[model samples]
Target chain A: MASVTFDHVVKRYTSDLTVVKDFNVEVADKEFMVLVGPSGCGKSTALRMLAGLESISEGQIRIGDRVINNIAAKDRDIAMVFQSYALYPHMSVYDNMAFPLQMQHMKKAEIDKRVKSASSSLGLGNFLDRKPRALSGGQRQRVALGRAIVRNPQVFLLDEPLSNLDAKLRAQTRIELQKLHRDLGTTFIYVTHDQVEAMTMGDRIAIMNAGILQQVGTPGDIYDHPANIFVAGFVGTPTMNFVAATVQDGVATASGFHVKLPKALPAAKGILGFRPEAVTDRIPDPDSAMEMKVDVVERLGSDQFLYGKVGGDSVTARVDPRIKVEPGDSIKLGLDTRTLHFFDSETELALL
Target chain B: MSVVSPATKPGSPATKPVNLERRSLLSAIRPSRAILNIVLVVSAVFWLVPTIGLAIISLRPESLFQQSGWWTALTAPSQLTLSNYQTLFAQGLVARGVLDSLITSLEITVPATLLVTIISSLTAYSLVFGRWPGRSVVFLVIVGLLVVPIQVALIPVVQEYRVFGDLSGFNPFGTIPGVVIFHVAFGLPFGIFLMYNFYSGIPKEMLEAGRIDGAGEWQLFRRVALPLGLPAAASLMIFQFIWVWNDLLVALIFLGNNKHATLTIFLFEQTRTLAANYWIISTGAMISIFIPLIVFFSFQRYFVRGVLAGAVK
Candidate 1:
């Protein structure tokens, strides 16, 4: 078992540009750690640095007790599933899976046993003799996974491993990956830009933005309590609604709606943040009901989303699908004040 | 091998979309295509007639070879005999010397082809994947070297070989090794150019994947880069082999009057003699043609693409 530590890791390309700025994260042993962010956000760079495919410009990264800064990629005792899969074309599926084991100078019987077991586990037993070119995309991806798992390395680094898969396969693989983490009991450092993968797969998610670590917390912690405006806006679908508001005496008021805050932070002007699901059709708190000028209404069987204007700020509300609402309707929706997050307008940091 | 089903198939293209390609062979032969086929066949026949004539002449007796055209033997089959070849065999110096030249040609060509191929592939691999500084600059320098013709390097290289011999006491002149060295040197830049361009198209991720699999740099080259580079390397080998096999200038300038006279020099010597030995020239020409033909045919099967089709998304 190995836990990876990145101490003040900085990836600077030049004097003027730095990709990962003083990043620090300690993944516990056997923990499923995900680095999630937008494109060009240096999440992949951080993972690459950990995988020894990239060099750390400053500071150090340690796996278990060893500082792996100078270690060659082959000696890092780690396996990675790339976005492109990168299967060896000349090798058969069986050979591809056994390549690393053979590279270790393993005995033929041991190599065969591991390769057969890994390929069978990956459901690639039937296609073991086929070259990579003859297989489908999903099959080739499984061969890549089979190759990585066959070695049973100390750590697994998956860089958007499911990105090349279709949507249905990605969802299926996400569950299998979590199960894999459980079975292997190895530290998994997964990097992806897809928030749903982060939320559904990672045991602990480290959200990064613009080369800086934004927040490190469990899915529930990140979902319920975002660290700042960026995390709030990035983590959820239909996005969180942000309203420029004035906070005074524990009361936050926007253009048309006003809500009472639980506790007041030391800020006069702040941004009010709330997820789409927080606004409901049922009026739980009639006192906090606000008027919404609905511009578009979407019914998705399970939920209904209303995209509209609550005064000058546009907001989206997820309500009971049974509730009938349409465009150009002026509706009264209840905002759960308990779920509200107040961010300091100047700093964009969450206040409550 | 193709999706074009026979007309008898249940799911033939006739059921839908009016496919023209699946029509009967007779109908498929359009006027334009027929004309194209005829033109191609005629051109091919025209191109091969000289080699056919040489083969016939090589089989004929010297008396028949001098008296009649080679085409006359096509109708008079009895006139063709192996006596000329027998006479060639009987003449020990001429026949043994020709065979020796053939052996010498192989020695020069094989090593030149092999050395150029291996060194060029290694150099190209370094230029493409080695993380050192000035890689593109180095590649550009090699590309610049490609424009330099062997004619320009002939005198300087000969002088350099002398200097090398004077310093080392193993002067390259009067030996086939000297000719091989020249061919390998001139073949390298083009060989590297072809290989570098080819290796550039391979996905860099495959090599990175190799590294992650605990493969050392040499293993990555041997296992990944080398296998994927076969087609380019094969063609480079064939080109180098044929070019060296047919070369006269470098052999004459470097390996002059040596025991290992190459086939090209042997043919040149045939013409230099006062009698102008047509028999040796034609017979030797046939041997020279056959060597490259066999080489080309043997290597052509490896020029396959799509080996990397599913290696990545």
Candidate 2:
């Protein structure tokens, strides 16, 4: 297994149309790096370029110490599992797994041994003799993974591999994939559009938006510290709440509420950011709290979410499940002071 | 098993005669199927009437031709004789001409079918998978050639073949190879067009997966693209085979030499004689029909749609 590196990579279809711009990342040996973004964010294009499935329009991608810009995909020593499983439908599971090794002219006994071990590891022992058409969706996905594992490539690239599975199966396979990476200890470059998959699966997550890299950090780092307003709004579930506010001399004030900034303001006016769970339902008091008229209450068994308006700004607050409230009810919610973020009005960079 | 009486069970909450009545109602559609079967059988018989008459005419003695229509002989089973077969065999009609035509037809059909299947698949693979400059334009050109008549190319092709023969010392015209070559060329445009359109529908991810599996272009075509393309290939083969098999003009013009006549030419020869040998022509026709039927039935399984069924979730 080898580390992969992309140096100032750029993909432009024409003069005006660029899909990946000045992208750079170094995936250390055995590191599971995930590229996450919304649709048309060029994550798949970046992965494809590394796989040699796409041509590099400007920069170089290196595996180990050698540049692979001109290399053929078959010579790149990387295996990709597709969102659509892309299994060979006519071949049995055993043949599908053995195909890459067989193409390399590996010995029959060795191909058989590797295929059997990979299938058994994936819990597909009983399905080796069946054609892909005979398998279910989850089983087909496992076969796709087994095919990749049997090759024992230098890097494993997965392009939204678990997106086809149902919610429960995706969760199960997510853990299984993490365990597989641990077992193999190979460099993995995974591309996905689901932020949760990226957050849960990667050692480091690279978030991209509109052909630009927004932030690159650990899951917790990205969660706790986003670099900009987009990363703040995009990274969290129920998304971070953004309020139009004015900051003056380390104190930030908004409509019907006020909070002290952790540091001096970089701008007199900007947006304030906080997570839903960072706010709590409370009784209105003179010293603290933002008064909101609750428009809807969503009780998700273990937690409750209040969707409402704080003055003119729409906001969502995560409160205790036991605290019952109704629509059209005016309530006071207190924000956690330690978790607040301030951004410049023009630049939108995190100021606090 | 419960031992309750029917009267007591009737008014019970669990008891309902509705399900049993509905079961009977569901089964009531069997008569419609039977009626449909009868109609199918009648239609099949209607279609087979001419073929049955041909078989009857082929079996009747030559002396009975002027006496009445061959259908009259069908009423008298004893009137049917194997004299047509014996006479045809005695004259070397079955022995030499039939053998020659069989070889010629096979010589034309096998190569044409194989060439069309192989060449079309490769073309389809490129049109669908290969990212090159002007791929769509190339595909449109191939599709456009499908509309050109084979008759339009016959004279020019023969002239070109003569020049090639003069330079290479191998005369393609008036030979079995000439007929096969002509058929292969004319069959290719349609073959490539049909297969290309079908191959375009195969998901691109499958090819990408094959590449990531360390398969080179040749290996990918053989193991992934070709097998997935079997249905279209089989269809192209069937089309090319039947067309070359039924062709009379190309074979007659390109294979006019005495040694290279195909079944169509042989059948034509029978009609051109002073006394047309309907018996020999009909027998030859039946023999020629046998191969295509065998080919069609043998490859019928490949034509099943959804061979790529579970390739994707």
DockQ of candidates 1 onward, in order?
Answer: 0.75, 0.73
Pairs of residues at least 3 apart in sequence or in different chains that clash in candidate 1: none
Q: After superposition, which runs of candidate 1 have C-alpha atoms over 4 Å from their true positions?
A: B1-32, B89-96, B274-276
| Cα-based lDDT at residue B150, candidate 2 | 90
First chain of model 2: TM-score? 0.97
The local distance difference test score of each candidate is 0.89, 0.86
On the 0 to 100 scale, the lDDT of residue B298 in model 1 is 96
Please, what are the lDDT tens digits per residue for candidate 2 over residues A61-99?
A: 999998999988889889989889889888999998998
**TM-score, per-candidate, Cα-based:** 0.93, 0.93
Worst 10 residues of 1 chain A by lDDT: A258-267
The best candidate in terms of lDDT:
1
Give lDDT: candidate 2, residue B67.
Answer: 83
* Clashes, model 2: 0
